[model samples]
Target: MLIRSIRLAGFRNYTEAEIHPSDGVTVFTGNNAQGKTNILEAVYLCCTGRSHRTTHDKELIKNDHDFARVTVEADRADGMHDVEILLSRISRRRIKVAGNTVSKSGEMLGHITGVLFSPEDLRMVKDGPAERRRFVDMELSQLRPAYYYALQRYNRALKQRGALLRELINAPAASDTLDMWDAELAQSGQAIMTMRRDFIAKLSEQAGKTHEFVANGAEKMEVEYVPSVRAEESGEELRTRLEKELHRARQTDIRRQITSVGPHRDDVKILLNGLDARSFGSQGQVRTCALSMKLSELEIMKKESGEAPVLMLDDVMSELDPGRRRLLIRMLSGVQTLVTCTDIEDLAGADAGKIIRVHQATLQEA
Candidate 1:
């Protein structure tokens, strides 16, 4: 995958800007808050239907502007593609792919797949299970649209179930209505868990290999999918297990007023040398594990999609040690990568195809 150019208007600090990126590596350098990361954020928004930084769409619109627009032109293994996102306060955001407006957000999933690593991603190992779960969900959504729709269904059912549980807290007679939502959760959640199981199996293998490469074979990294409920049987069997578990935990869920057991409560376990990375690994180890997972994500996207996904690194070099930085650079050959950093010297000697200096929201070639 290659992103040829990105066009922006009223997005963040950019009033109007167009940038042409080379196929190899493009570097955007600037001081703090010069909109270096915002450029990458625009590209990420085109790749996925959401922002990496904020959840609110209105925040993406520049002050004094009612809308923010970002358009991306890329060349993938299949064909050339164009993705455009229009964020508006007047109505819901709109997406267009290849000049055709996409009705559902999931329809734009594979048009231009990308993998991004920012400083905040370091929390994947140090933070709670939500981080790891998000990692799985984002990657899978890009690779499989069916998985995305399944996730949507599962979340909807989960929301309804939670509301019902809350109402049951006030009146217990409605407990009879809970079985319908339980079945919905079981069916959709089973699909999600099965796919997650297979995807993590691949991720674990790739991450283990990458961790060994980065650690020089001195440490072993292990990644496992830890679903809230164990599933090791036919599809019907798994769904049945989920329904039974939800029903069995109904009293507990009513007391807490939340859906307590399912894929929504699942996690990815990261281990180093047979010890939990979140609890036992050093700070350096935690960062290394995160890096390994990201690299693995890039590789998996390439293999699964039949094209190398565009890689975005947002000021991550400063956080990595020199050796890890070198490893990352060595792995960028033949892959389209966009990197942002405060100083260009930190990434010295890497063959950057285009170097742009971002100062005062104005981009100038270095």
Candidate 2:
């Protein structure tokens, strides 16, 4: 899938902007604070129905403006699709695909898959588990709608269970109330865990292979799924094990006033030669591994959807070495990629003819 064009009104720093993006290597070049990243963020929002930078929808609107609008034209397997998003101050945001309002956000996944790489992503390896979990969750949500539904259900159940736990803590006599919530939580949590395990397994296989190539065959990397509950089985047997573990942790959970074991506490562990990469790997190693994982995710999405996702590189080429940058460009040969940089000179040896310069959110054809 690729974005053909985009129109923005009252968004961030852009008042009224209409951009026709090229499918092959459209470059956004501008100095800092010139709305270079904002354009890419608009495209990212169109793909996921959420912003990569902030959670507040109102912040996306320009100051003193009550609403913001984004219209995206993308080419998918079905045909060219027009996605429209309306952000208002007092009402919930609106999303429409080809003039049809999308009541449920889950229905929007997989239509237009996107991969965003930024300087913030390089810290995903050293950051908290939430960051890594987000990495896995974001891709899985786009690849599998079932996983997205499960995640929504799991999050709701967790909140309800936590509330019950708090209630039980206030009145220990209501201990019986926790049983029902526990059962519900276990059912959904177990399903999420099973799906996550399967997902990480596939992801690790592809990421490891890619990492080896990116490392110049000098380093071997392994991705492992670290679940909070340990069991040596699969399928129903695994579910049974999880149930029993949850039951066993009941007392400890009550003492702590929090649910302690589930996918919420799980992690994706990166290992290089049997050592934890998150703690011991060099900064370069960590960044390379993250990049490898993202590229592998793109390949997986293509295999599942039969179309390459629109690739967005937001000032990330500046962070990579010349060899790695070349490798990334070569890998995206068949896909449409939009890259953001401070200057076209940064692309130095790469194809300069395709560069689209940006000056204060306006594109200048090369």
In order, the Cα lDDT scores of the candidates are 0.89, 0.80
lDDT of 2 by residue, 1-366 (tens): 878788999999888888776777788887888888888889888877778898999999988789999988888879988878899998999988888999988877776678888777766677877888888888888888887887888788778878877776667787566666666666777777777788788878888888877777768887888888873455677767766777788778877978898778888887887788889989888888888878888888888789999888888778778887777777777778888898666676666326666777666776
TM-score winner among the candidates?
A: 1
Model 2: which residue pairs collide?
Answer: none
lDDT of 2: 0.80
Clashes of 2: 0
Candidate 2 all-Cα RMSD: 1.9
lDDT of 1 by residue, 1-366 (tens): 888889999999989899999888999998998999999999989988878899999999998899999999998767799899999989999999998898999998888789888888878998999989988999899989999999999999999998898898889998667989999999998999999999999999999999998766769998999999996663888999999999999999999888889999999999898889999988778888988998898899888877898999898778778887787788889889899999898887578999999997799998
Worst 10 residues of 2 by lDDT: 348-357
**TM-score, one value per model:** 0.97, 0.94
